[model samples]
Target: MIKDIDKSDVIGPKSIDSPFLGSIPVERLSGGVKTLILMNNDSEHIFNASACGDNCAKWILKIAEKKDLIIRLGYLMDFGKDEFDIEIVNIGKTVHNSLELAETVLDNHLI
Candidate 1:
């Protein structure tokens, strides 16, 4: 996540080496990474996934593969072109890809 989202390297347990910002504490990471970390580690609450950008979608799906993840998105998040099984809790519909998800959201005014 540090490398992918921040373009930095994890130098230690609590430090990251960022080319733009130099060394910084883990707390100084982007909100998207922080949110992803919370979602990955915590299973007790639903996260507002809109805090994440499209770049974070793959990581979100990866986290879902490890556990049941429930998240709320204020807008449609492009989960790339790959096939994925994601249930729209609002309509109780399971969509397999971006097209299906778009259709479901449009048909139901979910977005």
Candidate 2:
């Protein structure tokens, strides 16, 4: 959690319905910006794209529910380096806040 952000700043794990059927649990990742964690297949992936607000999280989850779609999205996003099996995890919009970005990576763990 960031110092200035209170619990009210956080949303979901409730608000955004499960987009991948009953699989992925979406929640607000800690930061002043609107970031999210999408969990599925026993793994957690971060989501913070320019188009990816809380609602976009659900849309991404819905589109990439299948393995093939995940792979395609990863390639399109140029996530050519990471070894994660689920490539959809590599998709990102844009960082809304750099401080929150750091906190998300350093402090938050969706897993």
Candidate 3:
């Protein structure tokens, strides 16, 4: 079961450098939640999940780079109303594979 995260816990805008991905911004959105937003042209794909353990950001960046679909995350906060929308395709399998690949690469040396 996925636990709900409070918005007040988010902390970041931290910049990380990568030879392949360039400069990417990562944020710890909550105790177990982390997110990264990727900009492709005018569209922004926001990736968020609770699995952002050690090395999760790097793997997430890789997933964002590999996907062909564009996903958008929208949150509405007005008069105490809270709602969100996430648009994407093959998210689960794709992200799982990407994270696994990233872990493997991290464990080994890249050439």
Clashes of each: 0, 4, 0
lDDT of each candidate versus the true structure: 0.91, 0.32, 0.34
Q: Candidate 2, after superposition: displacement of residue 19 in Å?
A: 25
Candidate 1 C-alpha lDDT tens digits along 7-49 = 9999899998989999999998888998999999988888889
What lDDT does model 2 reach? Answer: 0.32
lDDT of 1 at 108: 93
Mark the 10 consecutive residues where model 3 has the least summed lDDT: 75-84
Which whole-number lDDT from 0 to 100 does residue 7 have in model 3? 24
Clashing pairs in 2: 49-93, 49-94, 50-93, 50-94
TM-score of each: 0.93, 0.22, 0.19
Tens digits of per-residue lDDT for model 3, 1-111: 012222232223475443444454544233233342332232444443333343333433445465543433222111111222222332332323434434433444321
Candidate 3 error regions (>4 Å)? 1-48, 68-111
**Better structure of 1 and 3 per TM-score:** 1
Tens digit per residue, CA lDDT, model 2, 1-111: 211222333234444323233332233333322332232231345333442333333434444455323312211222223232232143342333434433443443421
